[model samples]
Target: MAYDADTSIDLTQYRSLIDLIESSAKRYGDKTAYVCLGKATSFNEIERDSRYFAAYLQHHTELQVGDRIAIQLPNITQFVIAAYGAIRAGLVLVNTNPLYTERELIHQFNDSGAKALVVLSDLLPTLNNVVASTQLKTVITTHALDLIAPQPQSQCEFTTITFTKVLAEGSCLAFTPVSAKLEDLAALQYTGGTTGLSKGAMLSHRNLIANAMQIKSRLSDRLVQGEEIFVAPLPVYHIYAFMVNLVLYFERGGCSVLIPNPRDIASLIKTLSEHPFTGFAGLNTLFVGLCHQPEFKSLNFSHLKVTISGGTALTQAAANVWQATTGCTISEGYGLSETSPVVSLNAPGLEQLGTIGKPVIETQVKILDLNDQEVPPGETGELAVKGPQVMSGYWNKPQETAMVMTQDGYFKTGDIAIATEDGFHKIVDRKKDMIIVSGFNVYPNEVEEVLSAHKEILECAVIGVEHEHSGEAVKAVIVLSSLSQDLEQTKADILRYCREQLTAYKVPKIIEFMESLPKSTVGKILRRELRN
Candidate 1:
């Protein structure tokens, strides 16, 4: 399908991401830019704080241009400050999840070669245990409400710097603006490695700027400069929310209400009640959970207009109930971590439920058979994409990158999709067996690796099972070396061990014991048989 005339946007307006941020701050200086914890931050304030942060990093820390700095934070005003500051200082941003376990943290920090990290104070205890293992030198910590309310803070047990101290000291130093090119490496977005360990997808400045423009063009009708307010319940650390809240919406002169904890449904509803929000961004689990709440059901959605669904598939039940409750239909979109994350999005009034809408502007999609040949329309095949929004390749893994990229330059999405006669596409299945729990990717290989480390487990395989709340959940089928009569205790003990090694979502919900798993002559476990 050709690019929709309605969603067409100029792709080359911004020279760099810094250009995008500074220009927007110039245009909407006094307007409200972000809201969190009952405090509103203005565009001018973001620009100023971020500038101070840049000056501090340049003078105080040994971090230089092109170095990597990780930001492990929730949706707060300080995240905006640290990200923009790091960008302005000519450093690459590594958006790390605060919920990451020590094992996961060690891999990402080491892989990215991150020398510095700005993290929430609550994560300090765990981080203190593993910071020495990585190449990290400077650690900056802050409370979630630290910037919102200037209170006396106790020093961290480990030697570290405070966020407020950086700002205060940076004010005395002079900041020299660093030159940036569109091709410069901006951020290292790590993907859930379905086949193995997660690898960083190097996103360039051009890729991010173009994606922001592409997504804005898709929502051209709904977004108004300086007039739109969006409630953001998604984690900003994820690329989906990162692109939307920090880049796309901020550049458009809009306000984003940041929700620190989305699992607290009552608090989220109460926060929604406080703002006459014009937009909301969420996925299936959030939509279903919110609609079932009595307080959410009774709230006034009179001003809500645009609701976006991404990060996972939108269920028919979720779509139906959301529209009935808010009188607004969700524009479900599709993308992967390798695509700057927005491949296609359904327009508000024209959304076709159960199908991802047309490809965004300047994006091309092809359905390919197992032989790498394009399949005829109305048939399911692996979806491949070519566009400005696609990442250059996997970071530092040239061979792995070459495997995914075709000779023709399209990136194989590893998803089974059907190209309809109408422009919209339906994702029927996945070519890779990757589980998505609560809109977060949970790869079986990673979980299996952790499980195999246990002394009791001889053989193990992980698979995704149907879950009503999270869309899909991780299930482990195992064969222990010795059969024990106390099955319940073994399960509980294994679960406890898993919680220590894996992130919350990656932990298997169900554990089933079997004599042996079905395997081929080559001795490879078949996850499909386990699923069956």
Candidate 2:
């Protein structure tokens, strides 16, 4: 509704994401493309290194054009090189979380059927036990300082080669050009499902390119070509950052200052002080955590013009504190992994607080009732979106895909929303039992499955509780077995076991023991009663 038919754009210029990468390299060769751990990698360097990495994947490995390559590293320069190279080699990028447990890694790797993996060196000890269980054949490891200088190599059953070595070997080999069509799969981004395990959302080059262009067009007034510097604290593996930092900012010739660990608030604040960033991307907790630090408030805010918020709903508390500190208004956006992540973002100046502003250009969003018909104006209902940025469907799961998609083309986002009379959309509640901790989606069933496996626990129900630090924290209520000994000790043991199976964000922060969990007459656990 924002743009008319006359302003509608076509995708004739850029063939694929590769075109955007090469175009930026040529335009801003000497400009900084990415900065990580005090080192700046220019656009030309990214181009050359990515080309080398792609060459090795093409000539050295036994990988085909459409094979999946998993990348499990924090926000580092290697992530950019590896992601770009994998795409250039005509392979589908499977962006993996660096903090994923062995169980998670096994499910994702086997689900995506990834043949190769590029992981952090420190994680090799963990991956050492897991790689043999998956379909991964080639494992390339890299340290944080690998690009700056060769770091000591760590060994594992499969992770014997370093990322540096691949680049060097690739430089010698004659590189063959691999062209991927826009309709081809670019990445398999995994998102938490209602089921215990997660599923991969198949995204095409067109889906990504369209979203990037759509957001860019929306924020055209704020972003300046070759001048903007976007501080990226969120994980690059996530679709939100992947679309914003990797595609949008990179194509616009903006430098992304990568923060490896956002949990380390001091280090994150220090990184901010070093760069005269023009833009920032973060979630509610990150915004609140950074604002609480004394070192953060004193930083220069003159250069900061736009602050983008996604991942979780932006709390009014976070928005107020961030604006009071950075002197920049927070533009909160609403999206899901199935939508290449951004459907609506608050407009730059006309931002209406407590609302996700308006839908981006070429995006159609409407609320649907229980009968799948359009809800009355200003009435809360399920939000369904029809957009070019929307993912084709969930990978390799026809039934799951059919469940979310409508008869027409709209993808039914499992969140309750209300459309304002003035064209703004506001999300009110989640239709699914998903818990959002910090910016990550944690499913109740996923955590409950892990807790149920513990010998000490009989039955468990996981629910989201309001957390001051993380937007919401996972709270597990359990009905202990008769065999259980000390209640407190059992709680500790169950939590310890959960940490081993689930990621840090997915683990239950609070555990409660009760005689029995609240359930209905049919014996189904009532999670709402637990939350109450």
Candidate 3:
């Protein structure tokens, strides 16, 4: 888990990822940086657009240096412009899920104290309701076609400030040059709020650049200078996809075939069949979902050289089906929002089918017990990581941040894993009671806490149950203080309340009523016992 030798990346090439785009704009100015819905954005065009947006934000808005800006958009080209523009403006970025509810959206916006938000048109209603309570002032919205050229600018149905307006306003605004250091905070990635509440992991520019290089060094041969093609279906808001597909891939001047909506499996299959891809990265359920589709067998993946799976364990069955359909194995890996999302991965050259491979270049991983003592190899323990890619700390939550970080700068991942002799590692369990439903982490503690607050429920416990489509489904066991006079109506009420408060994946599928609950000797609820 510990590296004795050096794992340094050459810093002479570029100071940060933004610098990579700037450098590429100079070298491969006319090359395509992004491809979406048959429309492409050239490297030079991207640079000019981002710089203009950055200049506009700095001059028009009162956002100071290091102020956070929330970005909630899909896999469209605006995401790239907004992301790079925020960074270039010397502001930290806070990526948000477009599917978040008003409550979930409010929590993150307030927690990060975001000064502005650049969101898609469709998700504006969710943001509009909560903007009053949050510190956010400037709200910039764009349509999907705004990023693509040769389209009429007046063809947008969205109701907000458009890109055209921003450019016009920026005409008279004064531009101030600001220098952003390599070690400055770049992103505040919020953890998957499955445990209790989400915490923002503060990642610096150096952390993100180092992680990209770590991945680049491992697959340098497969990824040519400017010819690499990646199938980017995962949500850009998620850390895994953002780092691998958006940040790292774009920094290399590579091409990404964007899948705006992955839920449409048929459309995804057609898109894959039409294009040639060199790399594909996603979670276990995505591969499983595709393989189960009847049309998946007809797609051609002969050109694919590298495949990666993360965010959860790669089930053995899913791996076999993928390898059988395509001549390449699906390399499983592990990471968290705290590690710039790439800590370890199964190297394509030397991969174990069922295990997430060793730590990436410049990263060190260790398995430790509750006492922070190192555990023997092949034994399950909490996975701890220390590297340039690891987050500096959580934003504003000093006590919560200090609770997970070690004195030596290692972040306790809270994931249980066993490291093999061949450096392959397999995830066993998560310290936080979390259920991954449809490749999304659903925290039981958060659900249980919310359910227990209900007037009908006295105590509750939540656990994951096996499911074929979604890897796992949330199931809740409740001990009511008073017997339900109308059981069916009470169940419906609880489900309805959960739907309003939680996301679709986090809602419990099954609700069981109990007269009494299982507990430890100290009267603490035993969630493990409820699993049975």
- The numbered model that scores best in lDDT is 1
Alpha-carbon shift of residue 319 in model 2 (angstroms): 1.3
Residue range 35-135, candidate 2, lDDT tens digits: 99999999999999999999999988899999999999999999999999999899999999988999999999999999999989998989877888988
Model 1, which residues run further than 4 Å from truth?
Answer: 1-8, 151-157
lDDT score at residue 244, model 2, on the 0-100 scale: 89
- Which candidate would rank higher by TM-score, 2 or 3? 2
lDDT of each: 0.90, 0.89, 0.81
The TM-score ranking, best first, is 1, 2, 3
* lDDT over C-alpha atoms for residue 41 of model 2: 91
**Residues 275-361 of candidate 3: C-alpha lDDT, one tens digit per residue:** 788888877778878887878877778789888888767888888888888888887777888999888877675777777787888
Quantify how close model 3 is to the true structure by its C-alpha RMSD in Å: 3.1
The runs of at least 3 residues in candidate 2 whose Cα sits more than 4 Å from the true structure, single-residue gaps closed, are: 1-6
Count of backbone clashes, every candidate in sequence: 0, 0, 1
- Candidate 1 displacement at residue 10 in angstroms: 2.4
TM-score for model 3?
Answer: 0.93
- Model 1: per-residue Cα lDDT over 126-194, one tens digit each: 886778899888998888888867655444556788899999999898999988998999999998886
Measured against the true structure, the TM-scores of the candidates, in listed sequence, are 0.98, 0.97, 0.93
Error of 3 at 84 (Å): 0.7
Question: Scored by Cα lDDT, where does model 1 land?
Answer: 0.90
